[model samples]
Target: MRIISKIKTPGALKSSTSNLLGRFRHDDDGAMSYVAVTGALIMMVFGGIGIDMIHAELKRNKVQNTLDRAVLAAANMDNTMDPEFVVQEYFRAMNMSDALSGVSVDQSLNYKRVTADGNATMPSNFMSLLGVDTLQASGSATAEHGLTKIEISLVLDVSGSMGGNKIVQLRDAAKGFVDLMLPADGSDMVSISVIPYNATVNLGDTVSQYFTLDDVHDYSSCATFETNDFTSTAVDPSTELGRLGHFDPYNSSTSGGEIAKPWCATGQTSAVIAHSSDADVLKAHIDTLNAGGNTAIDLGMKWGAALLDPAARPAVQALSVAGFVAPEHSSRPAAYADSETLKFVVVMTDGQNTTQYDLKPEFKFGMSEVWVDTRGTNTLNDDRFAFRVQDNAGDDSDVYYWLGNSGQGYAMKYQNRPESSAISNGVEPYQMTNAELYSRFSIAAVASEFYYPAYVDGFLTYDDYANAYYGYQATVNGSQADTNLSTVCDSARDNGVVVYAIGVEAPQAGLDAMQDCASSVAHYFDVSGDDLNDTFSSIARSLQMLRLTQ
Candidate 1:
């Protein structure tokens, strides 16, 4: 009965239910604690995943940088290097071989491009719980190279100022530049023309015949341009334009004996080399460039620009036939609009322009001769005032003489001389003063066997004597030379020539000329003696810089 009451009574029942509830609550608390621990573990795993992702991103950045450099080095225009191998070598060098894949290369005449894409997978330190066993990092890089067909004309100043170390430095720097511009293997992609200019631009023996000679003195390779030449941009040899002579300034009377006609003729000619693709040939020619004579910037610029002028096609063609140029480049001095070709001129000078002189004959020799004999008595038989003139005797065997001065009408006398026939001494002589007779004889162009007695008046000055004895034209002074240089430079620029002027330890005149000649002031370089190599290298690198199009 007591056990039944405990099982059935309200107090006993309530107590039993409370005990069950308390047990249930205890179980709930245990389950909640387990859930909190699980949440913390999951959070820790996610945080590790974030850290791994950041590490992978860092690795990707490093790999991309390495690959970028690799592609650039591999895509350079050296001896056709294998792009894939070069990239692989770079990765190996960087100790990132696992990050390289999908490498490719493309090349053309004027451009070379390379692309490399790669990826790396990092073992997961966390996140494996969610099946993210590893993290992938990828990178890609592309690089393009620049190489273009170039036709360059170097108008070098071989003037007296470029004599000692200046020339040596120039030679070394120029040779180095050539080495950089030219491929180790032979290629016609680049052609260079060297024009060493002084008082004149010598087109060499082969290039001289292209012009018609104004004078019979092919003895010199120098020629002065007429005003028309400055106005005209085309250096067309077909125009029959200029006279060819030496650098002799003719003088009939001087401390030394009379200088023969064409006084300035007979000096060393300039050295000119046509366009050549062979670097060795170019360097050899540079070695032969000696320094002498006055500076003629206009002449140098003119000839240099002429070589790049479209009008010079005939000359270029002739050169090609003569084996001075490659046959494939026959169309050189290519049309200005040709995008595939670039024409560049590098003009260097260390000094300013100087006076230029040419020959101008005043008289014709063997045509006539006049002479005065002061020692002889005139027709009046006056002493100390006698004068005589000689003329053609009409007949080869006869001679005619006229004597008078002091305003006394002349008297004509004939003397028979059959041997004087070659002199054309048969004409009647006319009265003339000593000064007048001297002037007449000085102007005679033909060779005459005439003699003159000493006179009191020094009728002709040194310059006059020079002009009369030899055919020196009026002198073109420094100012005129500069004007001419500017003229020719302008013409060249108009024709689309890209000029780069470098002045080494030059004067103000030189600086001005170079500034005017350059395509822009930025293209001009004003360097001291030792900085020449740096300037040259800078230019070479600029020309060789890689151009990335993609």
Candidate 2:
């Protein structure tokens, strides 16, 4: 498209031609079109890069979170979860399988460490056109365990109901737990106190000195915990709170036999085994646990928490000095504020609460019943008296009057009788009725009237009349004991003690009570068919996790 024809002067023609050529070569008319296309391309590239960057960031965050969780799970002290599999599983669960890689675990005698690293390639958009196919994102995490000092009180229910296979299962499970918590070389910082409780807690003879020592049943190895013990979470043996007594079943046979069984039937005054790091010792003590006596869970729980309380430190020290408790654990009952120290109480029970009986301090040394009879004569009736006594005195007399009718009453009408040394005289008979004299004197005076009846009616002691005098108080049963057990459990929980309650073949009420006593709903277990081994193992695993987290 050229219409060519130009004529000008020689000088003007050269300048014009040069100007035309320069304009044709440097013209900006089409430059705007090319710039617009280039600008659009640049915008696309930047937008694609921004999008890819955001995608990479999101993928990296997801990978990091997943890896962290996987490592923690793999690092669980008691779990056998594989590190690589756990990491890959988590990634798959999150639908980020491409990011899973480099998973590893390092386990030691007392520690576990898990590490995981993962990478993902984020797809690029317009950047791919420039040879940028994808952006790589990576994440890594490591979880490790620290040495945690744990003090556990295994409060087992050695009640009559936990007999036979249940006890065996408990032993095996408990020994397994001990193995889990205690190091094989016995060099770890874990201590366990095995407390087998029933109607009462056996503190033994030496341990008795640590307590206030209720001398009523001083000869026994067990102690009946009072309501105050339940009210107070810590059982400070240094305080004059609880009393030492024989484990006397509420309604046990009193058929003129040997002394009542130790309240908890702890074989031959088996004193409580204080805190120990020796797993064998703990297992041995657990094996010695026998099932007998009524259920006094409160006592068991109270002592369990007590041994973990700092208030019992002095007692622990004393016991350690006396070689009763191990020297290393003498400083036990570490302060509650110790963050690195963990305290646990595994309370196992098989029955509901039962009646608990305790003996009074003083011997039951009085006559139970006294009666006066009027005999012979008309004007003045001669009064003869009868007396029955059951002596629980220290004179080696535990026998009650086993005579025909001498086993009936707790106390006689009079308390102090006239001295047997006093001369017996056939004096005068008062005009008072027989019942009148019977109602007026102390048990002792009634004894005098019976042995020296001449003073009242010029009559002799009757050889025929006899009656029984039951000395002990009536047995407490049902709701009373249940309330006691519940009260103690509440106290234990209130004191910030972590209680893991296990109910084995127990009544509904017992299961409910155990569930309520637990630190949380998840902390309770009910094994009706006697699968206590699994329950204990689960608890041990949970405890191991806790230790790892610490």
Candidate 3:
């Protein structure tokens, strides 16, 4: 009895231990309890902060990428605004859709900085337990057009063959280009040197010091209509080529022995075309043009280059962009910073090269009527070209290769003409043979006269003959005599001139050349038979597109 009482019962001891454990679990007491509660709360707060910061960082990164892309797009500044709108809109959409909103592009100019900014609000994922609801993120981007400058030269073909529709289209397009290049705002920065061409460009007395007998071929003197007033009476005053017969600048007596008709038809045609910067003057010149002349594209290009030579305008150089610079840029090193101004060239042509082969009158007795074998090929074969020999009258009698199926027989070659009328008197040689005989004349459209020889055999198919005629006149051996116009263009590019080529109604080779000459293949445009306004507008659109991209 005494031992049991002293040891205390096992049940009692167990009850005591259980009570202590329950108290420990239920009571908030002591330093350990305080430490546990504080640690958990701290962790929750930190987790919320971490999640918010991560989301904010992501939003900022996204905004940065979009702004970078948009700025780059603006830097390329060309004539088109569509691309710029598309680029800026895309980023704006992304910003609005994502946690971000209020993204926008401000001041997108070629030479100026393009800027973009955006902001975002995102919910905190892990921090919700700590009462933290959201976080904010923002970003910005900016870019600038480079300091490269440029010099532009325009080598345009205004040959006699470009008379009708082609000339009209060119006048409209060229003027549009000038308007585009004109300073949209500010004192004009870009400089232009205009070269209006024919067999020779007319520099006028102001630049006549550059002209001399050396510039003329054959006659020892260029036949100025003013110098030969008596013979120029038949010339019309409304046409550009015809303008030669009169003189500009009113004088009691003008250049021609005859009193000048106040103004020559073509004299002001490109009126003040090359010499002035005023839009009104350019407009007047554009109004006066009437196409007429043999093509001398080489001479035209050469003179165009001369206008932009750095040595010519030391001061204007600072206003020019160094290279790859166009009209739309916002800032650049001064043009006068270098020896030359920013330079470039846009060469355009409709008809191919043509040399006056022969202007000899048909009335000469026993004289062989000149015939040009217009069967020129793109592929140069020595044997086919071996017989080419041009005489003083620009006549090439020897046949190299023919490009046709001969029509009926020899008799059909010479069609009906009254034989008694005499071939020497410029009678239609084919008509002299027989009334019923259908004839085939090569290049009949452009050539003034057609001749059929006595010993001729079968005739060629009319279709083949026509192609050979016109094709030859416009290709390798034609008015634009060189198949390698691109070589010259590329050379010009290396010398600081950006080359823009337009292949309007062009052949494959011509297109290829244009692609190579353009700043890029995308810069090249092919315009076939189409509306003039639309064609010019298409070109304008392209120019704008290029500005936006590059």
Candidate 4:
């Protein structure tokens, strides 16, 4: 229809065209409508362009505000800042009432990924007639804080239970931890300690300088059993407590129970792997460790104290023939001091203290009656609390706490007595019986009498079993355990050491141990088997950060 109209108007258009051409050729002053209409069209187009540009500038300002705020927030995370809180506050700061208050922020780790959704509402001028009332704009930005150096101790449990798929899991977890601590490319970052503790930790060959091994310790001289004297001089070897727990039918041992075998490495040793160096070597070592022997947590922990210990480095050099300590620049204290170095012991065990040695015992069997005394095991240290009452099933009623004083559980078993310290005149019993129980005795007298009972057990001496096989002397409270732990922790703290505790499939006893050792409850990790990796990584990161950074 438009084409037919143009064709029909051709004759009329020729007359109009001639007039328009004559005016343009002369640049005529009289004809002004054409110029006015053309100018109006140009202005209309430019008005829309101006509106678009203004919208773009506003969007750009919003993006800049988000980027600036997010970057500053990321930087503040290094001061032990909470990332979540920082993200929330930063975005809030970027959003303002007069400006973009509806800005949204997405946070992760230490950085904020921000997006600016420009206003969906705008006051349109010339463009509004095109059926557009508002224009939308958007942009994105990222910010992050600088991380510092870290020192971490990766104390792992390489005990018997960690066999099977567990070890494989450990390898993967350990590698992950290392990867996390390492700087992305080049940064003087973190250091790690891989301590694998079983019955005894193997500090490897570095031990001779710091330890005296079992060969030097006579197994027979370790400690002795009960008071009764047997008619035959030779007792069954089966009843003997091993130097290390007698090897289980599963453990490598001629006898079933090897008393206390060495748990810590013979020297100032710890886990072997790539430490502060390459990853594959350390991971390989972790993979290679076999879960073996009894769990000598105390010994393993003490050795853990040594490997990261600066004091032991000097001693390692003294035993050069073994070639355990390399005489290199890295071994120097200064070399170590500059880098963030962490010492950690992640000990996990499903057992309790089994091996207690260094005492003696003497027992005599009299016709159907067993009379027991100490030939070994106890040594007299006035400071060491000796259990005044013996609490075997037959004797619990006769013991001290059964009568009273349950909270003061850590009784010093006189450490120096050659014979049973319990019955010795120098050793007194804890008279638990109160004065109320004693008609003639005053409260003071009764308290003194039972709290320090004169009638001691002859077997309670320097030479007795630390404890009998499955003979659990009830710990009235966590007193004894706490004292032992407190002594170690305070000493370490005095020396500026940070002690961490891990409860890995641990019993209440183990939990107490970790609590006793940890600087605070937050530093302790109570975990089931699967959570071990998470716990390990958390510890590794903490230790790494503690050492590597300010």
Candidate 5:
């Protein structure tokens, strides 16, 4: 262990240092160690940058989710709070109030839209080494809750079956629905037409003025629709509608009074209230509904769809001018292609289609063969016999005789023509027109007092008498009514009209028809007891159309 220190000259020292440096550079013993050190430094820098990116992404996701929920809550039409305040509260509850950048809200009486922008900043951990101090996360979202315009046709069944407690419940439910649709604040964006249908739809005087109807009688304002009318959704004002005759076939008493329960419902309250947003007016009309006729679901559905169609715009404008409809809705019932407007029909029925009565073509209007001997009183009673002029086919001679109380034959005979001769005392016979005859007597009364006697007298067969003047003919049967309902419903669906069908304790046939007519299975409601109000509320909620636009 002798440690000896040796010193060399400057030139020798330089040569030795150069030889040692060359050896150090060329040696392979410690090469792997040097590479491991450099690799570790580079991995550390990249791993820190990845961590910073992950933190920024997490913050961005939090901001995006919060903004989305905030905007949606703020856009809700039912939310009465200020939209900006709502959004701030949403972010504050999530402990991210500092991340909210700003909020924007656009609103109207019927619609509300909200947009929210938010951002968050995450301090960089290792990325700062590459000149980055912090990472930024930002997002924006928008949501809207409303339909620009809504047109609803509420077709209600006021048939005989809907009488009693059922009608009372309907009135309450319908009035509640009206209150929901036409808010007290009053938005002109929505208009509702209440069509109450039984055997026929009563047009009322105001609504009937727009249509050209046959001059049969002015007792009631109801039209007889052809089967082809159900194939389309427009009730053309230019088309002439046949007026339903005012005659009661159910009552046969020869009493001198008005015919009870004519085929058409004849009253101001039974008439349709079209394109109105006044809750008071609509509710008042609902209050006066008296049920007495058979069901006509097809007619109700047709009228509901027709009123929503743009083809009825002219009539709506006329109604608006007449002060029946709100002036603001004169341009409503917007075109089917109008994206901003929504058309909906809520058809509710409690029974299936029954027999619909209509007069025969020959009996609808004109002079009749029978003459009334008024006895100078001008009143039609049992004492005032109706004289019939029967023809002898062999000689073509007219034989006039007064109809007797019995259904077999005449009570008396007139030698000369009855119109010219004094039938009783000094009272002359008066030729009765068809209108006068129907107005004076019921169909049953005429058939029993005149036609039945003719059949018994062998002048006419039983079948001919029954077909001629007995009860009214069934112009529309049940099967045909179902077909018509389906046709109109299909037309409505094809035209982009949303149909909501409800069967309130209805029969199987009625339920089936309503289900088939609905826009979807969910749109059809088979409600009973106390379910009507809930079903209507569900429908109202669905109509809100709330969604996020961004």
Candidate 6:
């Protein structure tokens, strides 16, 4: 039996095809695979973008760090090369020279400021798919090296203990410091005041004229400050000060044109050279320093702080007019609140504070009881004598006199009835003032001739004679001097003044005092021999104020 295939009509085939298509569209099989492929594509895009962003950040950080270092190095005051060149070299060393866009340098006599800007362009990797062809990394930095105005006070110890090699080393170290601080081009922005101190601070005649000093004698220009003066940094020019006596307690004779060594040094070497920018003048003054007196670190610090105080501006201006201070520094000792100015004080000492002598108020001025006969030879018993005159009535009535060896040769009391004829002929009695007495004879000679005779003649008691013998007394003891130093040091720091102290082979007390006076522990130096030079050099480096501003 042969069978024939049946064929469907066109309409029936179309209906069957439609039914198959609908089933295919409704089926859920393999639907998860399509979602999985879309998710993977999204994840790949995000990961690539993150990687490109991290790479750009790394490049940005590198540019910023390199620019910061370059500006800082270029701003260094000690860098002799061109600032722009220095910055360029720094970038070249980092192999990022092409990234440096620009460099700017601003410099003055004592100041230098540098600014740098850089940018790096990196090709975008995965980010390119988002139409970003390149990424830019940019950085900027600024640095400042020096202060606009710098005032420094060098308080050097020229005491007897600083003799020999110690002084030589100090001179070399201090000169080296000057060379570092003061540029050879003669910068007007820096001024140094050299205050060489020992028993007292000698304000040179040019500087002393700006102050109101007691008119005791014209022999020296040393002022005796009160205890309260150390509590503040100001040395008011209008403040009247007591004058130290010009008598020497060591020598007994004024023969052979020998000058008395007064409590205050009289020579130009020990005097303060205020607010000078001339290194040669300052070094010359340092060369003349001779160690011969006791230590007075307190006085030295006081003058050092005072010279940096704004209250002393008038005196500085006066000094400038008088040619002692540089004319460009006439306005110096800028206000403490001035942001553009910086002040520093360097105190060096080899010993602790010693006795500071001052004449008693009674002996400071006015007539003394001692009398001299100008006609006789210059002998203690014949020429100079003291009279013990007593008013019996207590109302300027009858007076009794005990004449001291005026050729009468006896301790006899004579009534007021003795006229000029009663005494020996040609024996002219001259009542000398205390100032005159001290000016003519040494303190030792006066004590020997006058005080001893008064005690022997029963006019003065033994205690009274002892007091009179030592005309000068200690004004401030060692302990009190140390306290004064602390007070001044604190005031200086409070006023924004940087204090650096050095103890060169000093005793324990001296070292402690210097350490306490320093602004911080790092600001104090304990050294000996040649180490002082290194200490000063370190200080010079610290004072340059090199720092990054941005």
Task: Give one digit per residue, the lDDT tens place, for model 1 in 1-550.
Answer: 3554334689888998999978877777545666778999888988988888899889888888887788888888764768789999999998889889789888765467889988888887876777888888888888876646677788888888899998888887777777767766565677777888877677767666555545434554555687657765577767665654342342232111123433222332445766677788778878766676678888888888877877877877888888878887767778777887778888889999887665343331122233333233333222111122232346454333322222333222223331222332333333343223232222232111122221112322455434444544555778887888888788778877788899999999989989998989889999986998788777776776475443
Could you tell me every candidate's TM-score relative to the true structure? 0.62, 0.63, 0.45, 0.42, 0.82, 0.82
Q: What tens-digit string does per-residue lDDT give for candidate 2 at 129-224?
A: 779887888888888763457778888887788778877887888888888777685545677887778777777656557767544334455655
Poorest 10 consecutive residues of model 1 by lDDT? 446-455
Q: How accurate is candidate 1 locally (lDDT)?
A: 0.66
92 in model 6: Cα distance from truth in Å? 2.0
Q: Write the per-residue lDDT of candidate 4 for residues 260-345, one digit (tens) a residue.
A: 23333332233432124335445666666666554545544444444455544444344333443333413422223444333444
Candidate 4 lDDT for residue 543: 49
Tens digits of per-residue lDDT for model 3, 92-131: 6775545334334443333444555556677877666667
Worst 10 residues of 5 by lDDT: 407-416
- Pitting candidate 4 against candidate 6, the one with the higher TM-score is 6
Model 2 has an lDDT value of: 0.64
Candidate 5, residue 70: Cα displacement in angstroms equals 2.2
Query: In model 5, which runs have C-alpha deviations exceeding 4 angstroms?
Result: 1-61, 107-111, 123-136, 144-147, 372-385, 391-397, 401-436, 469-471
Winner on TM-score (1 vs 3): 1
**List of clashing residue pairs for candidate 5:** none
Question: What number of backbone clashes does candidate 4 have, counting pairs of residues 3 or more apart or in separate chains?
Answer: 98
Clash number by candidate, in order: 28, 24, 60, 98, 0, 0
User: How high is the CA lDDT of each candidate model?
Assistant: 0.66, 0.64, 0.43, 0.43, 0.82, 0.82
